[model samples]
Target chain A: MSDKSITRRDFLVKTAQGASLAVTGGLLWAYLVRQEAKAQPYALRPPGALAEMDFNAACIKCGQCVNACPPDILKLAPAGANLPIGTPYFEPRTGACIMCPDIPCLIACPTGALAPELKDINKARMGLAVIDIENCLSWKGLRCEVCHRDCPLKGKAITLETDPRGLSKHAVFRPMVNSDYCTGCGICEKACPTEVAAIRILPPALVQGKIGDHYRLGWTFDTEITQDFKPSEQAPPAPETSGGKPAGMDYLNDGGGL
Target chain B: MNTPADLSHSKLVSRPLGARLWSWRYVVLRRLSQFGILLLFFGTAHWAWEWPAKTPLLTGNLSASELFGRIPMADPFAVLQIFLSGHVLQQKVILGAAIVLGFYLLVGGRVFCAWACPVNMVTDLAGWLRARLPIPAMFVVSRNIRYFVLAASLVLSALTGLAAFEWVSPVGMMHREIIFGLGAGAMALTAIFLFDLLILKNGWCGHLCPLGGFWSLVGRTALVRVRFDKTTCTHCGECARVCPEPQVLNLKRLEETGFVTSGECSNCGRCSPLCPEGSLAFDLRPLIRKHGAEGSISSVRRTK
Candidate 1:
């Protein structure tokens, strides 16, 4: 073979090699991105953050939000943290978001990863706080209501539901989270007195469930209660009399056979 | 013509200490540029360094940043990838990307790789060590492979609905991890270092970096370029020896164009300082035009 020219077999082998290498590398790189993008579903983002998928796509991973945070609670997730690399997140257990009135982090965000439309910090939903009933001091018939007391929205976000203990003079007040008012700022989680934090913050998508439109409670005033099922106009005929003894035997009037 | 013996590396080393340090002026400036950028970001984030207006001096990593609470800057290639992923970026980030794009269009695009990229420091160290270690290359790959990788990154970003290269880029990993805090991102840097040091020479930047490939394409219309004087050149091969992207130093092409014409030339200022014949120097495109016209007139007079 000439030094410059290659045989057809050589050309085929080279092409095959290049194609296989490209396919292998492309698959591995794609897998890495997929894993990184969905690494931590439970990670709590800064206030006004977009939905998880949108946040992942939109965040440039600059950490400006981390700098703007007044309480220094926000951190850009480094690699191996199991969150998307360089994306800003906060751990409520250590340093919860203070729910700054100004919402500096949201304002500092160059991208709309933290939605700019969020003017009121009170409405920002970073995550949902879910109480572990088994471990909660309030649920165990105690007077501890630290979570409710420390909630930024106070009575509106978390209301106490009074329940009388069985035959006991004292009552237990359970802290109930109102989803409509709860901002998920995580101040309540930080205030919980439990050793391991009974009230923990979680991404709403991970914990919140939707009630589909298929079912409706008729008792509720909002439910229209459409009469989709109607009864037949003519009722069934009355049962036929078995005998002429006034349709049935009168046990009380019958004489004793004995 | 002067011989190669007149401009040996030994002669440079034998100069006075001040003169010898002067020879490394570009290298020192490059290191300062790289670390100084990192320091500004780190100090603002960690130490709360603020401007007179009480905003951060510089916030964010190299991927994106806000300077003095007002000016926005972003990586154009990264933004492009994100755009290709079907995300409608906010006006701030889009404007930031445009500003950066326009700046790189004025200067050479690969200026970021040589001056600002933290990964460049790691790769440069690996290259320095590789030259001294006598390690044999384990493989050979064409430099054009980076262009292919660049193409694939765009295609994959569209296909996957994520910025494909940003997710796994060692450049992002090194800078972000350093400024924020250390993490497993260092592992990627280590892999690139070893690959460049032992497996291949200048493997990451020269052969496989899609970001570098993107910048190389942008560099085609750059105003600043390395001017080459063919008459003074002795073909001693000194400039090519020190060059990271040595293929850009093709003597025949330089002789024809009177300047480094290839977009792949990074304008790193490495070859210019070390040129034995003093043939290579940084020149503006407009100045080169005037010089070309004057040289043509002089040559016409000589013919007469």
Candidate 2:
């Protein structure tokens, strides 16, 4: 028993066992975590899937949490990203998390990987997406607030752009995003509907966050737009994997300009 | 740890210690088991989740859209892919033959314990877990039940198929609810496993699953089997008690009288190490060199 007590060799054995256990856990995690098959966010689940967020590494490949996401804000990396198979990606167009006290996606994820026991979305660790000045339409002297109107935080994440000259007979058409209030919900990007979307959401790494606390959404200068505007229907579909059209996405064709 | 088995028949003479000292590579066999099981766990779970995502083109003989029509092989036996479906008494006859073949011809009833039955795997796992528990020691059942259970299962499966004895065949339930409709009536199955594992040790394989009945019969005439040197027998009786299957061998007169063997023995060698005398040895030869014995060597528990 004394020989079994804390010794360097014992420590090494424990570490090796722990390492193997962790790898096994990462593998076995598939069951314990409950990661499920996930199609694109817009497609319907076969009726029994819950969505959740990836809190551990924010990069699982399963995509369930992405689908169950209330906003349809999540997307997967093209095919191979370092993230876990069921990791969640965000899309802003469908709807924002709305900071719904319910946090449906978190509940849906079989793995706690996405779930934060925290009581609120405001508290959950989905990375915050901020507006980049170079990409914001308003920064380029164009009309935009798609980010402002769609954000559940509303006035907090965004503010109205008033008509400086009082040019018309109605409420100012100017739309602006509050650099301070934005949660990087990305609803704005999905909501923008721009050709090369003037406002877009990027990974949370875009801004450094405080440990144990959400990094507040911040906007900065980051963009290079070179495409002319076009309606979504007219926009060519995004290219897809070599396999058949993915489970929930349309295959992009090489057909000339739509 | 490497098995200390002596494969050579010429090992009657003592060997020099220097020649016998060879270090062995302790490849954790269980790690492979873990890897395989983990792969299955992840693969099945994740794959099953996707099954509902895409409408399957073909689910067995039933077409995708034909969710409400006749299926080609919805019978429980087909679903389980186990015994051929038909009648119970015939099944008994088949199981009885299978047991005989295992003992006399094919080595052991491994197929019954390995591939065909799910209860065996579950019990194997339970036995592993039982090692660390504070509960009472394990009690091995007589091996005769394997053939008995197998015979009973087949006959019952046939009976159920013909709409006679429905409650007895677990195979039918496995196929009908688990394979055909799937996720159907799993509650009944889960309850059975819970009862068998928690309340009784390996109860399903040892007592409930009739498929085990078939294997036990087969193992009896197995060419290689556990033999005891009664001279070393302190008569601790652990061999008799811990034997996973009953009627394995007679502990008292193993060397002299030779225990009755048949197709049903699994050759698990539970009694080998438990013998403090190390008198028990799994040998390649017959336990009793006696053809002088005139009992129709029972292949299974035949009413005794």
Candidate 3:
């Protein structure tokens, strides 16, 4: 039979062992969770997906959305994929979201990871399509504007700007992405003919920049400049001349202004 | 005085092949249940197998799924953790979880662990190999450790604002990966297999899995249970040896309760068919008490 009695030393040692194991195990688990949570930025979610933080917390990683997708573009990130494990993501180069009119994937989400508030597929900003100007055929003075032509919202999301060549009649029809309407469905990226896609979709947070509220374009038609700086209409009374010196000259002569 | 070795060799040599196979009926049934669930999920996802109504037969995996594109079914433990993490789930998934929870509450909670969990197959294989391979245990830990793990998972979910265990669960990883596609998730299963086979016996399921721990707690009031007949028992030690959780077979407790009372009994049906004297069998919890009373009266009459 084992000894039933415990010495004070034994009790202390046992308590310390249990505490240490719990602490060590807890810390290791927390570290793993932190690492997994940090991996969400690289993944592109389905249409109507919640913001990165909310989506991470909300997604049950069920792949119901993946199943509901008609084009079969979405995949649950498997372990060691470097994306949050089991969360649905898609690769645009291989298969991009077709932007299904019915929004089956959004309806399929059980956990509200894909927000139900999104009624229209056109509003989905899955990512922003960024152009590598140097590698782009259109930017190289060719007539290639496949992204502009193939965009679901062709005229609104992707618009062509004609730049005339110097000393020649040839003009480059450069494709520009308008953030207001671009859904980031990645059809443009898929349609890019370059060996490596010149136009690629990226999470908007990675590529989009904000001009803070401090700076406003006054020339714009509807500039919301709250208060414009103005000089006082009436100038304050001039300082009294000291020893017949010019106003504001006494400080200069006294070497106080420096 | 009869050990597991004597019972196995003596009993098996005399039995015909049909009788031998009959002994393994529950084991075979468990395998069928495990594989059949996986096949359904796989076929629906990949092959576009659908009902006559054109609804996919099953969508999603074990974490959550829908049957025939209408009835939702979800993992209750996972849903609970998500709720604890402060997510208000959609009605569809919450309903799904309720349906599954209600079913398990009636049958037995760990029935999910034995009948549905894919990880059980891998660990069962490890256990079978370990029993025959002469691998000594590396160390021993309290089985109660799983309860602590389960509590910790809940606390962690509340603290982290994420379904803490689901993020790292090997059970979820294995099931989701198999139905969808394979990935480094297999590594988790391999680690568990080696851990069960070499480091300890039934290490993952019995000692560490919080999901199993959750189900064990839920299984306490389950209707189905293993009924024990004390008069017929030979105490041959066959059932305990094969049992994943042998402590549940404590004869003194069984005698008093007239049934396995522990929530930890997974209703895996391993011990019932293997009982040499036909002492143990599955019965309804309500019927067990009546059977126990009748058994005592019959024994008293025999003595007189």
Candidate 4:
């Protein structure tokens, strides 16, 4: 712990090296984890799901999506250890939603979180959920194939993009879908739990057609769907010394605790 | 690095150990974690260093679970994978937590709050910087904010099918902002750093950071912890002095059993390292068969 053991300069360099090593080690662990990892995608979409939410800001992560569906097609989770929280998905354990008419799940949402229309009921309106370059399991150098076969937006939203550079030894892992033909079926959305969904639904009501959030801000942040968190109406006042307490009471002040 | 024999031989020497039945924790777990973190570093470095050379926008490993339906409702990493995929507030949260928890576990909690998380580091820097700048008045928010956040995230997910806060959540916002709002947020971040460091020492842990709140609570049930020797009791308040947060002493009290202030401790071990008496050593275990088995702990406050 002494600076004399290693010069300050040496310590900084070692820290940098340690930082790199630590990160590399973690990623290696993930890959090693992938080697033994067993979970796989459900082969089909639940029949009862309404339109899915977008990848980014679409769903508010309220857990209502999971509650609404009786078939247990929905599950909510956030990112990380025991982080069983945000971002709802479909499990389809006992029963799939089966593209039920009237989309019971969508109707339950108090917040239009899910699209009002079911995927096959008519034309779906969700925008496509895109994969990120940083964490797309495929991008992480692993070969993942859950987005394709499981997509309700099968032909359109959950398709693939190929490597034009011809560097990859295995180029056959292609899965892309057409956005125009795709309905914002949450099959892809509900299915995604990895850091990001390979495919997602954009709910038409929140997209261009009827999606409206001040239309002006829409011009700037089109990528964003709903604009919530507008300062809680009863915003509490910042906490401070109460009752105009004598300046001596504030522990942060000179005379208070010192 | 060799164990500091000299440091171990202070006035308050730890009585030599006999065949204690169990410690449950191991230094190698940390080593393995370190090794793991190292691999992740290289992977990301490889990704960043070789990005232009080879990029795969779609189609990852078929072997690994893709989006959800692939594995019913099991694989925990499945949801996490989706979160970190960088589409939303995709930060290296898993990696950050692992490295910090892993590396620091070998020593203490410094890594959890320092080495791994960019946000914690940044806030720590801000907490440090405030000493040099026109410090803003610091404020303390509800400690349960992270749970509130976790709850909100779940509620939001159910409502939207998306992680709504992944953008607003500090970690999420930091990740997205860095990649997308890089240019727009430079000055803002700098100001935040200064404010956080100078005005709110460890504000991310004490006031902000939902994740820290999350881990601190769970980690309290940790297999091992720092144990303080009372035979050489000086009550110097040294542990209290070096401590970065309130409630840690009471939290560490053996009587409290397995971190009474579980969520409060960051495991930084600052107090242990700084003690002149060398009275503190890490101890671990769940609550014993009987309460107050250790008698009144040195860490107990007058009120608690």
Q: Which candidate's DockQ is highest?
A: 1
Per-residue error (Å), model 4, residue B213: 2.2
Q: List the candidate 3 regions with Cα displacement exceeding 4 Å.
A: A1-12, A166-169, A221-258, B1-13, B296-304
DockQ of each: 0.67, 0.01, 0.66, 0.03
Regions of candidate 2 where Cα sits further than 4 Å from its true position: A1-258, B1-104, B114-118, B128-152, B157-193, B240-242, B246-249, B257-262, B286-304
Query: Per-residue lDDT tens digits of candidate 3, residues A1-258?
Result: 246566767889999998898878887887788789877686899999888877988899888888888999999999988898889999998899999988999998988999999999999989999999999999888889999999999999999988877226688889998999989899999999999999999999999899998888876757765346455799987779777655666668787657
Residue A24 error for model 3, in Å? 1.3
lDDT of each: 0.84, 0.42, 0.87, 0.43
Of models 1 and 2, which has the larger DockQ? Answer: 1
Expressed as tens digits, the lDDT of each residue in A145-170 for candidate 2 is 66677777777756766665544433
Error of 2 at B61 (Å): 17
Question: Which regions in candidate 1 have their CA more than 4 angstroms from the true location?
Answer: A1-16, A166-169, A226-258, B1-16, B292-304
lDDT of 4 by residue, A136-170 (tens): 56554456757666765465556666665434655
lDDT of 1: 0.84
Alpha carbon lDDT at A235, candidate 2: 68
